[model samples]
Target chain A: MTSLPALPTPKKLGLVIDLDVCVGCHACVVNCKEWNTGGYGAALSDQDPYGADVSGAWLNRIHTFEVVPQGGEIVGEAGEARIVHFPKSCLHCEDAPCVTVCPTGASYKRADDGIVLVDEDMCIGCGLCAWACPYGAREMDLAAGVMKKCTLCIDRIYNETIAEIDRQPACVRTCPANARHFGDLADPSSAVSIMVAERGGMDLMPEQGTRPVNKYLPPRARKPLASSTPLPKEDTTGATGFFAWLDDMLDRI
Target chain B: MHPAPSIIIFTTLSGLGYGLAVVLGLGLLDPATLATKIAHVLAIAMIGAGLMSSTLHLGNPQRAWRALSQWRSSWLSREGVMSIVTFVPLLWSAWVCVIESRYLALPGLAGSVLSLATVFCTAMIYTSLKSVQAWHTPLTPACYLLFAAAGGLVVASLFAFAGGGNASLLAVLAAVALMAAWIAKTAWRRNMLTLVPISTPETATGLGAIGKVRLFERPHVMENYLTHEMGFKIARKHAAKLWGIAVVLGGAVPVVALLVLAIVGQVSSAIAAMFACVALLSHIIGMLTERWLFFAEARHAVMNYYNG
Candidate 1:
């Protein structure tokens, strides 16, 4: 059997989010916390629970937004609105400012995969990288005195021990809504790439020009305002006569 | 943006070093004197010490040597490399100045130019970080260079007054520099006062649609490290008070003091030295407060969630 190569071309690992199918559930968020807490590399720790204090570690979260009618190509009916649940995480920006701000080389974009990783050994907990990030993606592991963020399950995604199909990020695998897709964005033939081309997928804050790798496919147009099913004719005669007779008898009794 | 104590010390010390070098270099062009040699030595020592102090701010000082590797994209790396590159010439100039050799004087002049270039590069490091709005402007580098010269002039004035080496000219230069510093400081304050924070709730969330968004349910309850570091903010009222003190004690008072001494013809060595110390202390405190405000006042786009 041939041995797997030690290193590969820079893998542009990223997410492709489908807004059409997401049900606004927090399953991905909970699953991420569980998997990451017990994962091989880094752990997210929560400080307090209950008793006027509740906080838990999460790598991702689902945010619900009601996009009301606004001045744009997209618009709602006079009394209609659509609710979208956005799952937020690090974009793994092409022009990563966080890496540059790190006085120590602890925060670095890997040359092999372009994944931004922190060398925990060198991180001094200065938190300058956090300031440099426009997106509040990276969080400090207060207990560990190091920075932590969505690693895209670097260990799991490439593990040979796990089955090929199962070797994806926990969040992507557990997304019941099938809203999240993970793949190499550099490949023009990837499923995510095809979906993006078909559906007009766009990045958030394109103006900032972080060149975010993640793509959010806008909600596709509603299916031509489907015709309503006709209601049955009113059951007037028999029901009306019977009700009137029963009421009269009861009053007499 | 907080201008940590280590950084403040580093910049101030190195600035003085470069400033003194400028004046001493000018002196060399005129004539070779023992006084110029002493000044040259002093400048080298100051620059060396300041550079050493800067290393303390680094998380991994040992990896400092590796900073030269990424000069392709980073101004910071360029600064690190330039600082080292200039040092060799500086040492050479010091040697020539000490030995009083006309043969090496030309090289000494070249070293002085190199030193100024390195100082300008260092200033640009701060000027380049676009995120730090306060330090991002062209005025930033200009102010740094000018302030360094102003500090050097004050020191030189003290020396001139003590040694009776044309105290009048030095005092006049000090007075003029102090006034210019005062004007620059006022402009800096004005710019900061009007500056707005970049981060907003809509921006942080990457939603083009904007109205308002608050942290209805915070991702975490207890203060995380992000809150401790990037979430720092000072009340508007307190910042104003600090600014007032910074402007008065840091800017106005120094100019007035220097002018008063010069007008009275009491620009003696002791008085000039005292004024320099006073001005230095004022500027230091002002810069500290200004830097604090720089960080504190900046509203990170992340903060929009909290504020909204």
Candidate 2:
């Protein structure tokens, strides 16, 4: 059961995250924890809640980074600062290391949709699977004594009970900026695939050879560190007689 | 990368246990002697205790039996199977030596081969994990094998001396194995200190195309499982001190004691045996320190994100 499927999954269902639009709000992370706690195998447990040392297992995580161009100041002294929000979850890689390292066959990747999952019933909580993963996606539910990870909302994505519009993964639906996109990545015609192509989506640590299904759209290029052009002057031509008088008085002041 | 006491005990005691078992399997000492019989029993007991210690760290030890089912893909599973399979020949050899009062060549050699193989399987569990850059290498298995052989030779020499067998040659061989293990460990430590990280913040977030990325904020304000488990670090000064101690106790002291026992010409078995016992004790404690350092200094790939 730990061996990867002989044939590639045709669907390759995954997420495409647009870094240009993510607001660092962590809404996707919160909603992911909210939905997965109730929908998946085990409830994500938090230890020492409301205490000085609070810890828990969460399926989704967002890291914020400040990008500074070479030779540019780290702080926004010249307005060159760029902050990027990075949201990460299970990439459901084609050759997931987590699946192959599981001694108990608890961690596996579905051949149909390519979603990596943990069968809680079979997990021995040895934590070898967690050590194998490069993305830090899997978490062990201490209360349940089993590994937990992003199922891509297996309960909701294909459910017939929910409304069609409500059936998408909770994180994607909850993203306020619509930075998260979901679809079958194997199909060129799929919306997510098209977006990836247009945006030149990239993999996280491609050198690790995980071949992650999830792709991240890099943040768009920012303005030069020191712009050669001057700031534009205010347009005074459209001011009416009263507005013009007020503008002229303000300019004089 | 936390140096959990359970794991340290498991690797150290198991390596010594299996090492002693491997030496006994070669029929190096007289099977009729009481010391040889005690040595065989000690090996089995050490292996058993070490295995039980490993299970103590598991969250669900009750379900650990299922871990043996996936040997086709998992090194951990392979280790489980190999360790269990190894017991058949080991027990058989033990029976032949104690109950029958003779060394059975077939079972003894087979058990020796299997015991070393089990140690190799144990090494593979760490070496196969690419996420821990320091552990993923050929040198890992080499270190484990050399140390096991060295530990086995040291203990076997003691039994040989007590059984009035060829103790001098075994003692010299123990010194050589100790040197080999320490030399290999030095190389491994050097490799760990000098390894250039392939994955960095630039590659992790993919925002490096624009510029150098620095972690401004973490997803959770509180300590999460990833941080708690993978974010262990050891002070450079502390690590250096421990390395020095491990070398003295595990390498220099044991090798010198074994060599002295050999040069003393076994004039007094009582004094020589006492020295051998001290050497074995030093080697165990030294190897325990080395194993603790193994876990403490190892930096996991996830630490790249945590800045640990």
The candidate scoring highest on lDDT is 2
Q: Candidate 1 residues A176-213, lDDT tens each?
A: 87999998777889998888888777766554456677
lDDT (Cα) of model 2: 0.88
Q: Measured with DockQ on alpha carbons, how good is candidate 2?
A: 0.81
Q: What's the CA RMSD for each of the models?
A: 6.5, 2.5
lDDT of 1 by residue, B1-308 (tens): 23356666677777767776665554422225444556667778888888888777554566566556555544556677777887776777767667853326555566667667777777776565544555667776666667677666665554454442454566567667756765775676577668865544455554434333334345444655455545667777998898788667655665666566566665456766566557656755664554455556644544444442
lDDT of 1 at B101: 39
Q: Per-residue lDDT for B1-308 in model 2, tens only?
A: 87889988988888988998898888887888888888889889989999999999788999999999999999899989988998988899888888887998888898899989989989999999888899999999999999999998888888777763688998999999999999999999999999998788888888778888788888888777787677778999999999999999999998999998898877677777778889988998899999999988998887767666
Q: How close is candidate 1 to the true structure, as a TM-score?
A: 0.75
* Model 1, C-alpha of A57: deviation from truth (Å): 8.5
Residue-by-residue lDDT tens digits, candidate 2, A1-253: 8888879998899999999999989899899989988887878888887799878888999988888887767774766768888899999899899999999888888888888889988999888888889889888888888888999999999999999998899999999999999899999999999999999999998878899999999888876746658887978888899998999899998
Model 2 spans with C-alpha error above 4 angstroms: A76-78, A228-253
In model 1, what is the error at residue A79, expressed in angstroms?
9.7
The C-alpha lDDT values of all candidates are 0.64, 0.88
DockQ of each: 0.18, 0.81
Error of 1 at A14 (Å): 0.5
